[model samples]
Target: MPEFKTEPYITDSHHHLSHQDFSSDIEEVIGRAREAGVEILIEGGGEVALPYYLKNCLSDPYLRNMYFCAGLHPHDAMNFSDSILDKLRSLATHKRFAGVGECGLDYHYDNSPRDVQKRVFRKHIELASELKKPLAIHARKSYRDVFGILEDEGVPEAGVLFHCFSGGDEDLARILEMDGYISIGGVLTFPNAVRTREVISSVPRERLLIETDAPYLAPQNVRGKRNEPSYIRYVADELANLWGLPVEDVYFITTYNARVFFNIDIDHGGDIVYKLGDRLYLNVTNRCTNRCSFCIRNFRDGLGGYYLKLRVEPTPDEVIKAIGIPGEYEEIVFCGYGEPLIRYDLVREVARYIKERGGRVRVNTNGIARLYHGVDAIEYVSNYVDVFSISLNATNGEEYNRICRPLYKGAYKEVLKSIERAKSLNKEVRVSFVESSGADLTGAEDMAEALGVSVR
Candidate 1:
C-alpha cells in the first residue's frame, strides 16, 4: 500500500487507549500517532477498565494531550451495577475527562438485553445533563431507539456526538435536527458503505468530525491490521474526497470541531488579518445579513489556515495593528466571514489608515449595505475604498431571493441600485458570481453588463 501523507494537524476524535490489545506497545503507538500529526486523542472509556488504563498511561507528558470519556457501553449494560455507575460518575469529574459516554445502544451484538440497554443509556444522558458535558455516543443498528431515548430524556445542552456514525439519510436528518455531531471513522473508506458516504456528503461541514476507533475498524487499506490514532489521516483523506475539499481543510476543520466539542483549550487568538499571496484580507466581524448557499462559513470558520470566527470584533486600532506596515502587500482587502460593510465606520477608519500608509484598499461586500444601513452606503464607502467587489450571485431578483436569502424583503433591487450607484460614483466596481449548481450565470453576466461593471 502507498504511504498516507500526514495532514498539518488531525484529531482522533474517538479511540480506545485502554484496550488490552495495545498495552505492551502503547508508548510506541502514541509516538507513531504524534509523528503522523494526530495532535489530540479522545480515548473511549466506556468499559469498566478505562480508569486503570488512564492511571497507567496519562502520566507521560507525551500523552498529556489525550482526553477520555467515561460511560457504560451497551455491551456492558448486562454487567451494569451501582458500583460501576459510581466509578463512572467519579471519573466524569476528572480533569482530563472530556465527556460522557461511548454509551448508546448496540442492537447488532445484543450483548445486553434491549430494555437494560435503554435504562443504562438514560442514566448516561441524565449524567451528561447534570454535569453539563458533551455525550459521546456509540450506536449501531439502534439509531432510531437512540434518538427516541435522547428525545425522551432531553438531550444535554452541552451537546451530543454520534461516534463512528454508520447511519442512513433518515438517521442523519434526525441527528442534524437535534444539532448533534457525527464523528466518522475508517468505515468511511469502505467500498460498499454507500449509504454512509451519502450521509457524509449531506452533513454540514461544521458538524462533521473524524475519528479512528483504533484497534477496531481499521480502514479498507489496512483492514486486517490493528487500528491506531496514526491512521486518522486516512479517515481525513477519505473525508476530503467526499467533501471535495483539501486534505488540510479537513484536518483543520475536524480539529477545530473536536476542540470546540470537547471544550479543549487551544490558542485560537482570532486571526484578524491573513495574507494570501500579495493581498491582505481583514476579518473584522462574523456578522452577515445574507445566508448564501455557497458561503464558506457554512462549512468552516475561515479561509486558508486562519480561524476568522472572532470572539469579539476588533477595533480600528486593533485592525491597523494587525495590518502593520500594510505596504508590504499589493493591496489590503476588507473581506472575511462577514459582510465588511456592516461595520461601515470601522472599515472607513481602517481603510484610511492603510491608505495613509501607501496601501491600496478594496472592499468585498454582498451589496445589501444600503439596505442594511438604510442609507446610500456606496457614496460613503467610495470615499475611502478604492475598489468594490460586490456579490451579484444571481441574475434576477427572484433568483437572488432564493440563493442569497437576504434579511431585507427587496434586497435584490437594493443590490442592483447599489451597483448602479457605485458605478455612478466612478468607483472601480467589479461584480462577482459564485457558480453554484443551477445558478443563472448568463443572466448574472448580462446584469453586470447592464450596470456597466466587469464580471469576475
Candidate 2:
C-alpha cells in the first residue's frame, strides 16, 4: 500500500496521545504527524489518562494544536466515583478541554455490569450538559441503549458524536435523525468490515468526520503496525474513495465538520464565494424572502462545507476578491442561503464583471424578486445573466403559500410574471422545484410547459 500523504492539512479528531505505547517516543510520533500534515490532534481516552493528557500532551510546545476530552470509559465504569466526576467537572472549565467522553456503554466487552455502564453514561451526559460541551460517545454492541439514554437525557445543544462508529443502516438513520455526527477510523479501510463501509457510504457528508483512534484499529495496509495521527490520511483516502470525491474535498469537509463539532479554534474560511464541481456560488446574504419549511439552515448551520451565515453582508468587491478569476469555473452562480436579488446592484455589477471576463452567469432565485423590489427584477438582471434558474417551488399559489410562506402577498403570481419577463428578454429561463420539499412535480412541469420554459 502507498503512503497516504496527499492532503496539505488534516485532523485526527480522536486519538490517545498519552497512551503508554507512545510514552518512550511521543515527540517522534507528533513530528511524523506534523510532517504528514496532521495539524489538529484531539486526545481522548478513559478518565485515568486525562491528567497526563492535559499536563503532557496539551502542554507540549511541539504539539501546539492539541486538545483533550475527559471522561470515564465504560470498561472502567466500576471505578466511577465522585472524585473522578469532580476532576472532570474542574477540567471542563479549562479552555483546552474540548469535550466530555469516550464514555458510553460497551456491551461487547461487558467489563462492567450493564446497569453500571448505563448509570455512568447518564452521569457523563449530565456533566456534558452542565458544561455545554459535546459528548464524544463510544458505543459497542449497545447502539439501542445509547440512543435510548441520549433521547431520555435529551441531547445537549453542543451535540453528540459516535466515535469510531461501527453501526448498521437502522443505527445510521437514527443517528442522522438525532443530528448526531459519525466519526470513521481505519476500520473503514478493512475489506471485511462490510457493515462499517455501508454506514460510511450512507452517512451525510456534512455529519461525517474522520479519526485515527490510534494505537488501535490500524488500516489494513498497515494492519499490525502501531497507528498514529499520521495514518489519518489513510482513513481519509478510504472515505474519499467511498464518497467518489477528491481527497482534498474529503479533507476539507471532514475537517470542517470536526472543527464545528469540537468547537476547535481553526480558520473556518467563512467564505463568500465557494466552488462546487465546475460552478462557483456567491453567498451575498443570509436574508431570505421566504421561510421554506425544508430549508437546511433550520437543521444545521451551513451548506456544502461553507458557513453561509454572514455576520455582515460582503461588498461586491469582497465577493469578487474571493472569486479571484471567474472564467476558470463553468459559471458564476448567484445562489446561497438568501435571495441574491435583494442586492440587485451588487449582482448586476458582479454579473457584468464576470460576463466581461468571458464567464457565464446564472441566478437562482425564488422568482419573487420583483415582489420584493416592486419592480421587474428579471428584466433588470436579464441583460447580464445568461441563465435565470427561478424557484417555481409549488404548482399553484395556494400550495406556494402553504410551502414557501412568502413575506409578500400574491408572491406566486409575481413569480410567474418574473419568469415570463425573463423569457421575453430572451434569457435562458429554467424553473426549479424541490421534489423532496412536497412540491407537485407533475403540476410544476405542466406549468413550466405552458410558460414555454424548462423545468429541472
Candidate 3:
C-alpha cells in the first residue's frame, strides 16, 4: 500500500530438494522459489544434493548460497552400511553443507530394523557433534527414543532443529529446552491440524521456521500435488493467526531464526507467507460502505500485515494480476474490510477470471453494487457470479440508512435497487442479516418475500 518494494523471499531450512519429486527440473524449482521470494532453500538432508557437492555436483551450488544437509533417513536405515555413513560424513565437510541427519526413528513405519535405525541415527548424531554443526532431525512417533538419544549424545555444537515438527507442546518445550529450533510444515495449515496449531500457538515467534518439506507433506491446496517452496504463504498465514501477528512478522521472525540458526545468508525474510490458500483474500480497498461491528479488517490492518493491504485500490487487471492464473482458490472472495463494489470494474474482471477457470466467485457486499458500480455491475453478475451472499441490513431506505450508515447519498435506495438486480441475475442469492437487535427483522422478511430472495 505504501509502494515500498517489499522483499518477496524466505529461507526454507528443511526440504528434500534432491528427491525425485524435483528430478525433472531442479532449476525450475530454484527459479519458482525465487519468484515466490525464496532466496535460500536449505535441503533437510538429501543424498541427491551430494553429487552437487562432488566438486562438480552442480555449478557453484554452495557458493550460490544454496545448501544441503546429508544423512541416512531412518526409514532407509537398512541401507546404512559403513560405506554409506562414510559417504555422508564426507559431504558434511562441504562449505555449502550445513547440519546433519533428518534421520530419526519412525515408529509409524519401522521399515528399517529398529536396532539398525537406532544405530544409524546415533551415527548421525555423532557426525553432527564431530563436525561441530547442527543436526536436522526427523522425529515421527518416536520422540521418546529420538529425544533420549539427542539428550544423551549431547546436541551438536551447531545445535539441533526439529524439521517439519508435528509434535505436542510438551515435546516442543522439551526440544526448546534442548536449544532446538522448531521448523513447522504444511500440517499447520490443515483445519484439523489441531496439534500443529497447538505447537504453533505455544512456541515463541523467535523459535520457529517454516518449511514445505517438499515433494512431501504438501500444504492443503497442493495436497497430492508436488509441493514447492513458493506455497509457504499458507503456512505463514496460519502461523500468523495462531500467534496473533502478521504474516510478514511471522516470516521475519522465522527467517531471522533460520538465518541465525542455520548460519546461511541471502535475505530470507521479505513478504513471507506460508502457502497461497485457495481464496487469495484481497482487501482491494479498506473503504467499506457499511461499518460492520465485527470487521477485523477495519480495526486491524491487512490480516496480520499480509500485505492484503488494499491501500492503492487495484484496477480489475491489477486484481486479476494479484489473482494470477485464477486456480489458486476454490473461489476468490471479493469480501474485504470495505465494499468491493467500490471498484466495480475490478470485481467484474476478477469474476471473469474465476468464470473462465470454471472457478466460483463470492462478493460480500451490502447489496449496493448497482448503486456503486452502476447497472453494469448486475449485468456482469448474470453470467459471472456463481454465488452471492449480500448483506440485507434492512428492508427500507430509512432503516437501511440508519444501520449501514452508507456515505453515498441515497445509499439505502441504491442497496434496495442492487438487491433487486442481484436476484434477477444470480440464481443463488442469500441476503444475510448480522443477527443484531438494531436490524428490522420483520421488515427484512417482508422485503425478502417481495423480492423472492430469502433473508437470513
Question: Which model scores highest in TM-score?
Answer: 2
- After superposition, candidate 3 runs with Cα above 4 Å error: 1-8, 46-49, 52-63, 266-456
lDDT tens readout by residue for model 1, 225-295: 99999998888889889878768778877777887788874345566876654678898888898988778
lDDT of 3 at 47: 56
- List clash counts for every candidate, in order: 0, 0, 19
TM-score of 2: 0.84
Residues 256-336, candidate 2, lDDT per residue (tens digit)? Answer: 788889987534435577666577888888888899887876765655445666667888888877777878888889988
Which candidate do you rate higher for TM-score, 1 or 3?
1
User: Which stretches of model 2 miss by more than 4 angstroms?
Assistant: 1-11, 20-41, 48-66, 107-119, 144-157, 173-179, 204-206, 244-256, 263-270
* Candidates, ranked, TM-score: 2, 1, 3
Worst 10 residues of 1 by lDDT: 1-10
TM-score of each: 0.72, 0.84, 0.56
Off by over 4 Å in 1: 1-8, 56-60, 63-65, 266-268, 273-307, 311-334, 337-363, 366-388, 391-428, 432-446, 454-456
Error of 1 at 223 (Å): 2.2
What is the lDDT, from 0 to 100, of the residue 352 in candidate 3? 77
